[model samples]
Target: MNESSVKPSEQLSRTLAAGSPLIYVVTWEEERLEQMLARASQELFGDDRPVWQWTAALGFTSGPGADRQLLDPVEALSFVVSESVDAICLMKDLPALFESRPALVRALRDVYDHLSVRPGSMVVSHPSINIPPGLSKEVYLLELPLPDADELRGMLGSLNSGFGEEQRVSDEWLDRVSYATQGLSSNETRDLFHQLVSEKIVDVDAALAEINLAKAQLLMKENCLEVITKKYDIDKIGGLSKLKSWVISRQKLFTKEAQAARIDVPAGILMMGVSGCGKSLAAKTIPSVWGLPLIRLDMNKIMSGGWGAPEVAWERAIRAAENAAPVVLWIDEIENSFGFLNDSATSGNMTIFSSFLTWMQEKPANVFVAATANRIEILPPEMIRKGRFDQLFFVDLPEAPARIDILRIHILGQGGDPEEFDLNHLAKVMNGWTAAEIEQMVRAARIDAFTDGREITYDDLIHNIYRIVPLSKTMSEQLNALRIWSHNRATKAH
Candidate 1:
């Protein structure tokens, strides 16, 4: 889109002049915002620049003397109302103080009302929305999204101007950088681009990767979302043809081509089953399958802090996930995270869970949430709603055939002769064992062989199985409860 097409400031000015006063702009880039305000000022007053300055060092003084005075938000707001400063008064970093200082919110509202009747205008700019309840009616909130492709291209062109051989950079690389930095600030983009060049990995793809890493860090801090860059393809994982096929069927829906064709991307999937099932593996491997990075939301980090703190963390986490779009967000042990949703004492937790459910219900198609849970009973009904998750599949312990596949995969990975192993006999003997337990038994057999200075044999596996107890045995009641619940609600993993 062209710069002319995205004139948010012009829209804001028009709104204010049309009698809907008090524009509140939420944006991360203070510098870009100032440029927008300057453009708006030029649009408002021809030839004469509208005086604007922010900072408490110099108080607000308009016209000839106004250019030098820097004032706090309250003081600037007061000056705008009292002195009738025709200029648009811009305030930065004021949202952090709005909630704490009721008086300031009241003052801004008062100034807004004063400007509503007069010719003057005031604009509040911050990276977040913090309008006080009292000022909600007076303030009009607007989001200044990150610069679009054209704006980013213009920035790159300006940055490269008058530079010699050192300024060498490919248009494709710049385009990739622009595409990667969908929610990043101008400074973040510059820092990331230079970091790539400084590290001498200036190739287009590498530069895009570097930019992505920076974005991951910022989004991680914002949302308590852990960006998992470790590679795990379907090939790394053994066969799960059914599950793999399910994922492949909707893969095209996530692409730009699919979006252009007016197809809605699938919301997400919920994988529930017994412990040691390949649910977790499927969650991790999805990023590789979709060619997107994986992000694991750390509930431990999210749960820390006093009352009402989790709300901030939750919002930040969701924002982070949204920012890292066209990616997989894995919430392992999702049961534990929302376990308290039904309890009255966990109002905060419930609030957090509700927020998450709402996000999951309405999240952009690009954000594929792979949430896994062992205890489905603890999960709230809202989470399993059709719109929240496209499909809910039960990932029970591998059946006879899947177990055989799992065994072959494990044995081949360890250089064992699958032909010599009695796959049918082993499957029958390990009826209730999970894929994890089977793997453990295999490892135990290997250990026995190494300890005895002999080759691992079927006898070693049988001996190990005798010594180990599976989840179906130890947590029989819970396993039975889950199985019964899944009878009508979930798709059984064969």
Candidate 2:
């Protein structure tokens, strides 16, 4: 069955209607979920089944028999079991309290066991909860998703006053605004809207800037993904014309029009080649040209075991990256992270690998992956399969034309006139050097001229080229092996 046929609210109603006694809903937005749950309750439990809530801060504030304060976890569970009425009861933030009182955990399970005879439903809500093994079987886990575009638009539309064009915003403009605020909570969107409104003037451009900042902060708070604040312009990288052309052609994949046409978004590309051959630079800068946020994901950091196990952190990172949609997830030195995927002995590594592979396969289209690898053998066969990623490109050593382009780009970038230097001679001599190596040559050559207190000369560039040993010479065997592997398996990047 297609999952998109049913909305989240409808699914919640069905779960409760099917007599799932103890539902554990996960979300950070308490108020929003509570209202949604109330709607769900009325549909399943009828108008007379009073929906109530209890919390540590405000105990028994929203229900009947509101005589006493049940601030303790033990008392809350006792209240749920003791109250013999057809009323839905929700307990907020119960895990920590239950952690301290093991008796409450057992009591909760017992409550779940007998809740079927009571003719009511009990729900436990929290941002994230660790379900004890005792009650794991008794609880139905449901994650409350973030508000979608339609909900966000309704909230923003109410606050919008004379901001859009002709006193009415275009649908395209509204959609972009909606997409920009995709990852935010209802409360967060409300706060941002009010903040924008307090200036007493409305501007779509100004509002979008604030929304992007808020959305980025929402992703960063997860601690798994880091936002690339600085621009890595795709046009700055020289050479690799084939790869650049492929990337440029697919720029419209992220647009609303593409969505309307049901165009499949580009999954991603694996850039494998010599260490300094613009592979990493291409991965970093492609998002800029695509007009998407670039987020660097640290695989090791997620697996470091401080927050939780590697699998747990890995899932969070994937979800967090998806939440920041229209994003480029740059995984650098990917072989180091997934080398163990082929081993039967390394179970932990295999688990992380499996989780990542599933996410990449099933993830939302808005999250584009740009993974870079230097060692091809270490990558698992499953990782290179067509469905896992859109394509894999080999970033080979720069040819003469590519080298000249690299030389002139870096030379101009460093404020030296490419016209003043013998770029042809420099490019010819820089045979077998990668783009990174050529860039370093340009940099080093400038320093030589800087020490002499004058502009860099063509001879200075030639002089610097002799002092450096390119990666091709140092790792010739490895480079050759990579080239052989990519011959029939991957497309040529340059």
lDDT values for all models: 0.72, 0.79
Best by lDDT: 2
State every prediction's TM-score relative to the real structure. 0.77, 0.85
Question: What would the per-residue lDDT of candidate 2 be over residues 181-234, giving only the tens digit for each residue?
Answer: 777788987787667556632465556656656766777777767777566777
Question: Candidate 2 at 201: error in angstroms?
Answer: 11
Once fitted onto the true fold, the runs of candidate 2 whose alpha carbons sit more than 4 angstroms away are 1-5, 18-20, 41-50, 65-68, 73-87, 102-120, 132-138, 161-170, 193-216, 219-224, 302-309, 340-347
Instruction: Give lDDT: candidate 1, residue 81.
Output: 68
Q: Which stretches in model 1 have alpha-carbon errors above 4 Å?
A: 1-13, 16-21, 46-51, 57-86, 93-120, 128-137, 145-177, 197-212, 219-224, 255-262, 298-313, 340-353, 377-382, 411-432, 449-466, 472-488
lDDT of model 2 at residue 83? Answer: 73
Give the range of the ten consecutive residues with the poorest summed lDDT in model 1. 56-65
